[model samples]
Target: MIRTLYIDEMNTLHVCDSPYDIEVTPKWLWVDMSEPTKEENLLLSQFFHFHPLSIEDATTVKQRPKYKEYDDYLFFVFHAIDLRTMKPEEIDIFINSTLIVTYHKEASEEVDKVWHTMLNKKPNEKVTTNEVMYKTLDAIVDNYFPFVYDLEDKVFSFEDRHSVDISTENLIDETFDLREDLLLIRRTVLPMRDLVYRLLEGKVLALSKKQKIFLHHINDHLIKQVEMIESSREMTADIRDNYISLNSFRMNNIMKILTIYSVIFMPLTLIAGIYGMNFDVMPELHWKYGYLAVWIVMIAITVGMIGYFRIKKWF
Candidate 1:
């Protein structure tokens, strides 16, 4: 769907379905496109005379996070997490001195929010398209920090209270999940830092002094988040290695104990097997004391083997 927000020279705000509804050209106009149809996109080209390449890129809908400065306007692609499913959502923006256009395949709550906030300003207060772009960018950038910090918190918590039973399989599974989330975040945030930096060093719009300062701070925050994500990935790898080593040690100890028991029973099993032979003339079987003697021999052998193992410090 296509929607419009037009603020005229008298500092009045008009939300309209079409630009033709307004009698006078707006001083500041923002056209928002959501889940745009092919026909809707073609209308954009006719209305704005945007670079064909830019329009194609918008419709293709597989843009990476980037900022491209065109002859007449600046184009940017941003990624935000969808609140409902926690997946990446894209917002493409085009900004000129007096007009701003935003396109996305899905409805963005963030974009709607910035629009309302700006509309709430006093009616007599003048607004510019650059101001809208700055506000919208700020809103989208700010939206990221909460989710990043939450992920950071979860990672720290995982580090702090290490699970008691750190089985290798379970630890590996959990670490992989966390790593995947961080990777998603890193892909979006890192490019955003670069985009902000390029905007700061602009051939695009001449940012107001205030906007310049704001962009610098956003860039700083983004860089910090990238570092945090990198650290979290490293921590996951460490946890995985620790779990693997511990599990291997546990398995070795179990095997050692079983081997010791088997060794200790070897002679006893031989003695029992010899007496069980079905020879009618087995002399030792005929003696009543022979069973008692066999018990004493087996007990002595078991104790001796255990003592020898202890002296060698093999347990």
Candidate 2:
């Protein structure tokens, strides 16, 4: 999908036609492309001087989050958090002086919301391309915080409910999944954090002082976000380790119980096996009172073993 927005006199208008031309001078142009066709790729290359490698990277799905500074434009590849599934989606951005282009593998609701907000501005309002970009980037980054907090809440809930009788497998798997999400977020956010730092340092010739300050603000937010993500990753790892230890302890306990039961039954099994053997010298077997005497002896032995086990607290 491709959507274009051309801003004139601060009133935003959507341009629908492919290869659309605007007669009025556009202070800024925003192009959003998701799974772009060959034609669209060619159009971007021709109009924006986008590097072939950058275009290739944009089309390739699930590339690691990174940034590439071209001679004419800056390319940013990052992940946008999907709130519904708590997964990360790839978002690529290419920015030049007059135009800003975004490439994505799938639709992003957060990106859409930022686009709408920018489009609704009234005429005569002064909006820079940088400001729009800032808002768009910030919106994407901001959405992750709530998702991170939600993950923390989930961990707390699990701890509260299952602290005593927790399923080790389930707890460990959940923690690992959370760790994976945080790792993904870290890969996506850290590079962009560095990119924002560069922008603030005035490395981009297209940025103004005001724009740099705005980028710094965005960068600060990203820094805090990165810290939070790192912390979450560590926390999940700790939780996973704790669950593993708990599982080991539980297994040892079950083994001990089984061992005690086997020990208590060993003598009884031996006695039964010895008396079952038939022999000519077995005088007790021939006596009528022998059966009652053996029964009394076996009962006494069983009761004695039970008392011993209880005193030892083996159960």
Q: Against the true structure, whose TM-score is highest?
A: 1
Per-residue alpha-carbon lDDT of candidate 2 for residues 57-159, written as tens digits (9 for 90 to 100): 8876567666778887878777787777766788888887677888787788767887888777776576665666678778887887787677667666665
Where in model 2 is the C-alpha error above 4 Å? 1-20, 24-28, 120-126, 163-213, 226-251, 283-311
Question: Candidate 1: minimum summed lDDT over ten consecutive residues — where?
Answer: 159-168
TM-score of each: 0.83, 0.74
Provide the overall lDDT of each model, using Cα atoms, as 2-decimal numbers.
0.82, 0.75
In model 2, residue pairs whose N, Cα or C atoms come closer than 3 Å (at least 3 residues apart or on different chains), thus clashing, are none
Error of 1 at 54 (Å): 1.6
Determine which window of 10 residues in candidate 2 has minimal summed lDDT.
Answer: 10-19
TM-score of 1: 0.83
Instruction: List runs of model 1 lying over 4 Å from the truth.
Output: 9-11, 159-172, 201-204, 266-301
